[model samples]
Target: MDDLYDFQESFSYKLVKSETTSVIPSSVRKFQINFNFSFELDVSEWILSEDDESQLVSQSHHPVVDCLVSMSSAQFSSFEESQKYMEEKLTTTSSGLSRLKSSNRRELVDYALREAGKYTAGGGAHRVLNLHFDVLLEHEYIYLRDISNYDESTRHMVPAEDSSIDHALKTVEYSLDIPEMNCSVCLESLSGDDYYREELLSMPCAHIFHGDCIKKWLRTSHYCPLCRFEIPID
Candidate 1:
């Protein structure tokens, strides 16, 4: 009875023969029961797939990270080219400036020699030096006053009576040999025109003049033609 109650309460069962083996012993065998359990795990599904929507979302949030950066490279290249160009220009300008300085000094020396030679040959070095002293001072060359101090005897070398007469004779001979001087008004070389022969004014200072030029000059002030020696206007 107890075994019947136990079999009714549970489905699992085991069959065994009694120890006294009242029934056939070999006919009964033991049977064991077990409960089987299983669980389904879904691991194949992806959390974030590689699709167009996912790529678009990533690009929209951080666009600069994916963009190409080349502006700095282009700017650097331009700067290098500009630096080379400036260096080339500087080299050319420096050489040109050096040549210009050399040529200017040469021209100044030549000009000084020509003017000085004229005064020395004309026997008017003192007067010529006085006139051009200011020019020398402006150019920052040696001053004429300094030179005069070195040659104290030069102050007494003015033309004397006999020397003046000799100079006049030599000048007359030279004038006869030379072609008639140019007319200052017309700037044309004169060949003793009738207008110049009668009325032309020859300044006591060294310059020859046309009658008209002298009349115009006398209207302003009484002075010698070349040097500004005061004279009677009349």
Candidate 2:
């Protein structure tokens, strides 16, 4: 009986050792990680999961142990790298958008004019002109008379200058003199009754004005009549 008991104890000890020896160390166990990525306009997220089942079970015995052991150093490093890359990309994209907005003022004006034009077509000539005028005025507080001079025939003529900046400044001045039509630029009424007649000119950005005004403007600068957006003259 003593010998039998000794043999049983020896067998149990050997079995335990064998089991322990078969298990790979936590560091040696090959683990595969899968990353799930989510893409959005404002933010992004990632989920990490293990790919191997046998390795995962071998790493921990209890359910709680499984959770603790599942996380690997390599996986952590990968996640951190991915997060940094995403942050940098987002910052670059935001900066690009801001620059685009600042540099594309003329483009914005042109787009607005094109959209407004669609509604002006087939409308009364006066109505069409008024619509265009209103659209321009909405964006810029300019006087109506600077761009539209009245002739002896009471016909409206465009200014002869191509400089949109000058036109804007003149409009502001005119607005100031007229009290009844209190111009915001001048904060006064337009006092002049004199009117001139001339043909209007159109810029590549789709802004329209008197030919002379645009020409003179172009001599000094090349930009939209309403916005100081850069134009490629060459």
Which ten-residue region of model 2 has the weakest summed lDDT? Answer: 7-16
lDDT of 2 by residue, 82-188 (tens): 34433333223311111122323234333433443343343422211211111111121111222123232321112223344434432123333232331111111
List lDDT for all candidates, in order: 0.27, 0.28
Top TM-score hit: 1
Where does candidate 1 have its weakest 10-residue lDDT segment?
1-10
lDDT score, residue 212, model 2? 56
How far residue 47's Cα lies from its native spot in candidate 1, in Å, is 99
Candidate 1 residue-wise lDDT at 67: 9
Candidate 1: lDDT of 142? 13
What is the overall TM-score of model 1 with all chains considered together? 0.22
Q: Model 1 segments beyond 4 Å from truth? A: 1-175, 178-180, 184-186, 192-198
Model 2 ranges with Cα > 4 A deviation: 1-196
